[model samples]
Target: MKKVLIMIGNIALYLGVFYALLYLLRSTYNYEATQNFAKFLDVNPAMFMVVLFTLITLVYLIIFRIKGWIWPQEDKNLFRAAGFRRLSASRVLLMIALGLAGSLFSIGLIVIDDIAKQFPSIPALVDDLIRGDSIWYVILGAGLIGPAFEEILFRGLIFRELRRVMPVYAALVLQAGAYAYFQPSAALSVISIGSGLIYGVLYLRTGSLWAPILVQNTAMSTIFLFKYIGFYEWFGRLGDIWLYIITALCLIALIGGSVYVWRTSGNGGIGEQANGSTKGGLTV
Candidate 1:
């Protein structure tokens, strides 16, 4: 029954949000021309989707709560599934490695994006990502909101549940696939999938949600920082997917190494050693 409710709740959350978003965007304009219509909503589509999910997350949670679902409270032991018990040096290294590997995987998606022009995307999505002349918005989006939304949904909600029906590998892969499907662009599927897998693996190895969020948000903020600092041209750089891929690879290497070391070295203060535990929750 809980699993059935989870499946239903997830479907409703997405469907409701999709309907609402489409309605909001389409009702005031031509539904046929999404590109043309999207101009009116000035936020980054990714962030826009973030906002969308954040809003709908309430609906999701409300539904689950009404049904007596408890989030982050499923398996008592799995909380340490990804080795998140410490703030030690090894934990930090684990986060760095995970971040780097995740970013590198996302970087590879750039090439795939180019080769598959058939994939859908819009200029505004890129604009939203790079248009952060305001540092506060960048900080809020990249630092706080991005991490919170992603961590809660990915680690706290999804991973917490999947350990029951599947092995860690299958759980991670399926969750990654779902994460990719939620991305801003169809072209981003590979990027999202790869990054999601990296994150899931990190969670599996380390057990702490905070470590991955911290590392991911850092990477995200750094990319925005480049835009904030005007290190590259906005919108124009999207066309140069190779450079993005290369830069992503370098950044990934740096961060992934840092995360791995943090996770492994017991003496390090960021995350703790692996423990044999599993936990569950259903916060909708």
Candidate 2:
């Protein structure tokens, strides 16, 4: 409980740093530009915030290493400790497939909400980004930088820490909760948390940050692409019946992919270490 509390505190501190940097950066622009930029920031504050925080985290890691302050029990290599190890090509493809399915599954929420006459409220920044001409920034921020830092913060740090004290499933749930809390809105929160669960499982099974990172990148990239191409509005235009059918099909795909992974991959599920200790949430 104490550790959990500390983790929550660290999150608050991280958010504080993000807001401070955002304000400082925004202040440099003129009033009209600043207002526009602020809207862009709202589209996905996490994307920009993670850029600065990721750098800060890297520096902290370097200092901790130099001072021999970081725990030695974990792997000495930062990347390995963060689960950036190699996996078979097939495994990578499987991970991506699962990620795609998970993403499609999550869109069901949006369809349902739209039908309920409660379409998810997109962030003003996102609205502005779509209205404007340039979307390379959105692609870069949402697709790559956002997922990279998010995987580092959530799966690499928070989930890894929680696994030391609790069951893998419990840790996954806790980290998913954190993921949801950080999202822009209630609708997004639901999608993010659901996706986070699948990503958590992948990370634990493969012991690779790349797994979750790639999965995240795929999901975000797809959403950004869809949004930019106006697919979201098109989907909305499909009416309740079509949306329900699509959502049902999406759910089927999600479930089928999950079951396929479980049956085919030897390490798709969690395992315990030989020493009866939990390592990478896998049992050996």
Candidate 3:
């Protein structure tokens, strides 16, 4: 319980810092004016995301470095301790595929049309991003930088901390709930929880933070592709039966991929401790 409180405090700190920076930037720049000028120059408002995420990354590094300095032995190279490690080329490819599938599965679960309905602002935001001239900025900030930071925060740090005090299943659920709680809307919360679970599994199975980061990047990139090509609209036109069928297929693929990862993992799966210690080979 104490640990949970501390974890919550940490999450609050991160979020507070993020929002504070966002507020400062918004106050400093006239977003609407800049956006209008950007339109004239064939630029995108999504470029703001790149600046925001880059600054957040710097803040994270500085904060973690200070923590390391205070607790040298236990917290030295905190990111590495959070499972930032390398993997083979083949495994990296596998993770990417898994992430793509996971993203599709998440969409199927929610039904993209329903998502648009439940949270009108979401599709509006995506539309702005997809139609923007600085699409590369969108890709870098939303697809890569944002997901990488989230993987490190949610899967790498929070999930690992949860695992130290509870069973893997409990930890997974709690961390996913934490992820969901941070989302702005109910539809996004559901998607975040699902993706959180998938990313957590990838982190545990591969024993590397890169696994979740790569998978998350693939998932975000895939979503952007789908939105860019109007895939969601096309699929929505296919009626309820087709939606059900596709959802079923995506669910099956997601489950199969998860099973494959679980069986092939050298870390004894999620049953093992976050620190790679094992009491018994208990499967969770």
Candidate 4:
């Protein structure tokens, strides 16, 4: 119940920002103004994403402090005294394999028109990036920028906090669902959330942020690479039967491979609750 309340507030907080951002991009800023702003800033969505997410995190932290919520306890020590990292090497490999599998699985999601759509302007952003000289946008935005905001906020802040009130598994599942909602992709939403759920498990088991970061870096970079190379259209065309068929087959093969790996090598691989209050049992 506490997590639910936090989820509601967190959703509202982010949703309000999202709508404001939407309005700014659409009604407030005209095309020329938008372009001009993009030009002025090199229009790297990645950089913008970093700033936006960082601000959101800061705001969340502030809310936590004001409400006497003790989260993200400043354990600068964790970084300082690195003990034997517990992340299993086998699990790491499995996660990488799954990352690729997940991307292919998401291709099946393109079967629907609405599911084919991306974050507003993402397609255009891709094209503009191709025609323009915004190298920073592609590299910084996709690789470092987007992940920092989304993962840190959702996985680090929200999921960690939820652990205070619920079982780690429960919090992980809820965050995955929340992540799917955020992406709003058709079939891809499942992939996003499912893979996210696994990452959450890894984070829990490893007791550090590094596990999820590694997985996230791989996933985000691949997506950026797809967009960077102009192959997103092909993936987006998953609406056709052939694409779906091919994707499904590919997923089957990947799963088979993963199962084979698991059997042969042994072992399977493996966010936030909410809002400004941060008062609920959340510690980090």
Error at 211, model 4, angstroms? 2.5
lDDT of 3: 0.70
TM-scores of the candidates in the order shown: 0.60, 0.71, 0.78, 0.56
Instruction: Estimate, for each residue in 218-262, the C-alpha lDDT of model 2 and write its tens digit.
Output: 766676677777777777777777777777786676556545655
Candidate 2: stretches off by over 4 Å: 1-50, 63-77, 102-113, 122-133, 233-239, 262-284
Tens-digit lDDT track of model 1 for 1-284: 78757755654564666568546654544555665445533444444545554665565555555444355453333234323344446556555555545443433333344533554353234346555335666656654576656766766566656654556667778888878887777767766776677666555554556666767876666555554565445433556666565756765675466455446634522123333343332111
Clashing pairs in 2: 39-125, 43-125, 43-126, 83-209, 271-282, 271-283, 272-282, 272-283, 272-284
Full-model lDDT for every candidate: 0.55, 0.63, 0.70, 0.53
TM-score, candidate 1, is 0.60
Question: How should the candidates be ordered by TM-score, best one leading?
Answer: 3, 2, 1, 4
lDDT of 2: 0.63
Clashes of 4: 7
Better of 1 and 2 by TM-score: 2
Q: State how far residue 224 of model 1 sits from its true place (Å).
A: 0.9
lDDT of 3 by residue, 1-284 (tens): 88778667766777777888878666644576565544532345456666776787678778778877886755445466567766667778887887777667655544556645766755665666555665676677678887888877788777877776788889989899988998766777876787678778777887777877887788777777776677777777777677777777876776677678768888654334345532221121
Name the candidate, 1 or 4, with the larger TM-score value. Answer: 1
Worst 10 residues of 2 by lDDT: 274-283
